[model samples]
Target: MTTEDSARLAWFKSTYSGNEGGACLELATTPNAVHVRDSKKPTRAQIVFTRQSWAAFAGFTGRPR
Candidate 1:
């Protein structure tokens, strides 16, 4: 998506993020894709994932590879 499209998303930070300047991420979801970016740098490029791919990744992460 274009910058304009991304600007329209309602981004949400992960609940796991703390205020101590540790690793933080934000996510915004649409019917077609999931947008991910560093919470500290909202203007940076994002990693977009398809619904199926994101679902698989969400399920696989923090688990044994």
Candidate 2:
């Protein structure tokens, strides 16, 4: 998506993210995909993932190491 397209997305930070300004990320989701970007540098590059791919990643990360 273009910068303008992404700008219109309803981005929100992860609930786990703290307010202390450490590492943090924001995410925006659509029916088909998910968008992720650094909360501190929203204007920079962002990574987009298919919903299935994102769900797989989230499932893996949710598992115990």
Candidate 3:
């Protein structure tokens, strides 16, 4: 996505992220994609994943390790 497109995304961080942040990430979702970026560096490059791929990743992470 272009910088302009990224700028239009409503990015938000997890509520668990405290004011005294160490390593936090932000996410924005669309019908087709999920955008992820470092909370401390919003201007940096983001990682975009298709909705299906993101769902799979989320599901995997939720499973017991």
CA RMSD per model (angstroms): 2.1, 2.3, 2.4
Candidate 2 to truth, TM: 0.86
Across 1-65, the per-residue lDDT of candidate 3 in tens digits comes to 88788889999986667778688889999999999999878888999999999988877956587
For each candidate, the alpha-carbon lDDT, in order, equals: 0.89, 0.92, 0.87
Q: Model 1, residue 64: displacement in angstroms?
A: 6.3
Q: Tens digits of per-residue lDDT for model 1 on 1-65?
A: 78788899999888878888888999999999999999778888999999999999888868687
Clash pairs detected, candidate 1: none
Positional deviation of residue 53's Cα in model 3 after best superposition, in angstroms: 0.5
Q: Which ten contiguous residues of candidate 2 have the minimum total lDDT? A: 56-65
**Which pairs clash in model 2?**
none
Q: Poorest 10 consecutive residues of model 1 by lDDT?
A: 56-65
TM-score, per-candidate, Cα-based: 0.81, 0.86, 0.80
The TM-score ranking, best first, is 2, 1, 3
Q: Flag the better candidate by lDDT, 1 or 2.
A: 2
Candidate 2 lDDT over residue span 1-65, tens digit each: 78898899999998889999999989999988999999988989999999999988877956578
What's the lDDT for residue 29 in model 3?
Answer: 93
